[model samples]
Target chain A: MKERKSEGNEVKVRWYGYIVLVIAILFFSGVFTAFEGPLKALDFTNLAGDFGKLGTLEEGAGSLASNFRGTGGAGAKDAWMFAMTLFPTVMFALGVVKVVEYLDGLKAAQKLLTPLLRPLMGLPGISGLTLIASLQSADAGASMLNTLAEEGEITEKEKNIFAAFQFSGGGTLTNYLSSCAALFAFMTVPILVPLAVVIAFKIVGANLMRIYLNKVCKQ
Target chain B: MDKKVTPKKTVVDAFVEGARNGFGISANSMAPNVMFAFVLIQILNLTGLSDILGVIFQPVMGIFGLPGVAATVLIASFLSMGGGVGVAASLYSSGLINGTHISIMIPAIMLMGALLQYMGRILGTANVDNKYYPQLFAICFINAILSMFVMRLIVSL
Candidate 1:
């Protein structure tokens, strides 16, 4: 984590990053899905568009196209076909996420998260900031842990406990928000409630790991 | 004061780089994992394991005021969070589960979601010991189950 300051390099969070982050959130939220107007373009489902619908000659009378999957399919063959279709969605999403990162959008998020996660993670010093980075990306968090371990700043048991915290809701912010789009509209509670619970449980899970390592594993 | 020297790459280049990474993950990780899930589900159907599972899980699901079929959502989440939510949405639309159930499930799903993949991504990347993997997974399960109970209580209130 200290690597950032070695050459006096602190991340610059441009104002545009916040705007990009908001747009990114809306793009995935599916709010524009029902809009028939220009705002429909704001939605990922609308932006990716749809596969060509078969005309009267093929399936006829139906404006809705089932796309390539088509009806009953079983076993590996069907699985392959469906996975093929998912490629665009996953690729497009990460692509947008990448743009967000390049534009410092993730840093914009990190600035907000650092204060919250710092107290929750309870690391003594600079490492607290690194822990917050883990909330957005699993790789980033794990790498921070790896560095901390290498530096001997964290004990093995603490490392294991931290692993449990991260493993439970890996990439909590990005994965939760992006993947929860489908369930978001249907949720009766406010959006932040579930996310807050997930964070709380991540810590709960870490303590569970701590107990197991201390009492059961004894490793 | 000289402005910070930003990299010459434009946003479009960043997007392409990001998209390439996405393609790689889809091809390597997601495609195979999804295929594995699909085949596993098919085998469960063939062996009548799904029905057996439903019967077994119903009572546990009942504690949350959900149907036995809701177990599929949790199971899917264990494999992948998105998949779990997909299963929940489909079930909800079909009227098998209600809005309250989905609300209660949100945290539970996020807590346990994508463990199979994250084991490699998070722990392996962190260089955490191999022996700790099972216990860590168990912790996730414990957390998920506990959260559902809490969420159910909250929603009721």
Candidate 2:
């Protein structure tokens, strides 16, 4: 009876610890913090801020209206671009996944990937497809994981681990080319060097999550 | 001797079904996510909340050897990479930031960009439990910071 009581106390302490951690993260990331000054209130003098000029909160309403209309200014253009680029790819990739399923290609791929993934990331072979897709598109990779889980191809634990991997540096290749590459074009440092560094560390982070999930949330 | 064979779907049928399933997944999972995130990010972008965030995070950004003003670019990224790219390009053109600074910033930006949208759209569609979102963000942010340090060290070397 005493031992049971102590164990219960330990769980409570751990639970409280988690809550504290979450709260700290929120605070440090500026959930409670706000800047003081004109900058604090978004600048509306500029064209970007013109949208803000329509009315104090009107820009927000406009944004919502634009979303429904599937249109907007620059920001909406970008979002549309994202959808245009990714939606087709996702659509095509899903077809490919379908064909692969019929051909039993996933199993063959899994067999090939098992040695590498299981040993390094503690994930199943099927997760290899998701990883590869993640290089090009994180959404595709994540969606695939969802599909796999729903289909009973991977357990919940494996899904979580794979999700960790995707989250660490999702859209590895695409993002590098699109964002980092441009940012580095004029930089003195070689582009590949930083790119490689981010990838390596992202993998490290994914591994960290894998370890934690496996040990702590193994259920 | 007698042989038995199971009927199989024709290639065309398989392809059609695959396309259907693909579209279904995209529509059901990714479309709404994209729409919702687009709306939220649009609001944030137009309002310049991201700029406010930039000012607030200047000190922390300085730790990465980036100019405090670079927080603007970082904040813009949270809404969309294109905006982030635009901010970065302008900064680069104006000679506010250089290659070395960019090296550190790029990795960090990639980690934290598109926060609400990426979380709601990608991970949300995957049904990643909400409980893990904070943990995941924390892990990714830490990883970016670590990468920034490494990149900074390498560039300085």
Candidate 3:
């Protein structure tokens, strides 16, 4: 009974520590944004010019009166171009994950991650794979958790932790590309800082819930 | 009456079956999610909520080594995944932020996902007991706040 109380206290201390850390970071982020104002404004004008060029290309295509024109218009073509450029990388990542799974490489991964996870996050070893899987695809990671639950590879408590991990980590290739591409174009400090803040909050938020749920909820 | 043989299920059938059994969550949820995303975007645009959120987060955003207006993009990211991307694209096209800012924001947005509401569906599908859901959510909220802080620290250093 005494040990349990100490454990509970430890969790509380950790939780508060995280909270304080987050607040401090936000305060600092605000200062950083203030410092970056002028450069960001300059970048904004450059971005407008770049977008104008893209618009001109679209207008040029619209002026063309060929039989095969509309379907192959600049906007449509650009979208396709973007897709083609990104798809190969996604496919390659997927293929690598698939091959690894087929060879039971995940089991080895799980074994390796177990020690670190328990101490750092209170997550079980097998959950390491689920966490990694989530980084690639939310649906795939969730499905993996479901499979593990069905197969009894992890307990219900562990599954909840995995769920929280997924909640925190699940973002696909497309998300990364678009967000990055947009921010890169502008060089605006204002636009970049908050995006970073919220994302960090979400990740930490999800993980903290995982830890909390593990402790308070019954298995 | 003579001998009969059973045909094997095709790959597609097997695949469908696997998805059905494995996911367990309703595919129909996508419709609501998409619809909500649209509604959220419209509201943000109509009310100029994006700008407000940006202003609100500005002070806190400084430590993270990002600009104040980034809050708008972050809010967009939260309302709809695609909307956030659209905001990013527009910002990029407008030349508001640089490659480094973009790099920093990208990971942050990816880390956040569609947090609050989406988490409900996720936890629901996971069949997490209702009693713990609220507490878990609280923790998630706190975690997100902390994640922002950590990202700021990393970028600043």
Candidate 4:
């Protein structure tokens, strides 16, 4: 009975799923970043919000503004404070990801990605969901791919190529927004810039593996 | 056809579950890793090893438009992404590298992030042939270096 519902989920495509999926993409895409007021709510970084500054102790002549972590701190105590500041952002991003997944936003994307997966990554369309799953959880994706390999659904070359994508930047979505929040403040580019780079390289890395397998492996 | 009914999970519930996971991850993984990075940076600074590193890695890192000290972030990132970011943030705080350098280092950090850990988590679990592991590792390092070039171009623009 549980299997039936799970199958239905994979087959069913709700009309609202596409809409919410697009909204979710825009939310993470930084497209609405420049908008004002409530519109800014659509952007990830804006909704993640900023901390209150300590403000100037002196007049305009000598500005004294600093974050709650302050300045000139070193070692573990300083790292502790810095990490503390990051918790809220990570929490918000994960919470939103969960909310989107609950709404079937990611499944909607998986559906769309299924066809493109082949031409894009040299993967079969059936591996689309697993590839999407890899972005959220490395263990889950790896185990699922192993299942595919065990069942003889994917060829050895295909498994290796997919493994290449998963190896570098594994669990990308979770790790990037959550684990790498420390570098967010220092980044001069939009949040998506680095993410786009990582994703592009994941594909490139997989194709490079593909080239190696085709040319050298002789399998 | 008997269909078993399952209760729908509300959006709030989903968010709560994920947020709870975030708390656990931050406490267990991120916080300790960053603290470890901070201590590593301190040791490098106090031992005056950072300067020596700056001198040694200068030529290699300069190719990526990064300072020699920026090499530490990439090195730490190879072990754990959180540590790499911590090293980058620490360097930024010390005024060794600015926001532009951070932007350039961003993609490279995660492209090669947590490779040693994921070697088992990703490759071992997936059960890829052991013979290809060397090539797989090489591909990731190549991807990381290549991405830095792309990020450097974006930063310049």
Give the top-scoring candidate (DockQ): 4
Local distance difference test, each candidate: 0.74, 0.59, 0.48, 0.88
lDDT of 1 at A108: 69
lDDT tens digits, residue span A74-97, model 1:
667766776676667666766777
Docking class of 1: medium
User: Which digits, one per residue and each the tens of the lDDT, describe model 3 over residues B96-132?
Assistant: 4455555455555555556564565466556666776
> What is candidate 2's CA lDDT for residue B122?
68
TM-score of chain A of 4: 0.91
State the lDDT at B60 in candidate 2: 86
List of clashing residue pairs for candidate 2 = A187-B99
In model 4, the number of clashes is 0
Deviation in Å, model 4, residue A6 alpha carbon: 5.6
DockQ values for all predictions? 0.53, 0.21, 0.13, 0.81
lDDT of 2 by residue, B28-77 (tens): 64444344444544564569764576577779878888876677666666
> Per-residue lDDT for A198 in model 4?
94
Model 1: pairs clashing at backbone N, Cα or C within 3 Å: none
lDDT of 4 by residue, A79-144 (tens): 999999989988888898898888888888888878777888899877877888899999999998
Cα lDDT tens digits, model 3, A159-189, are 7766766665354432332323333333334
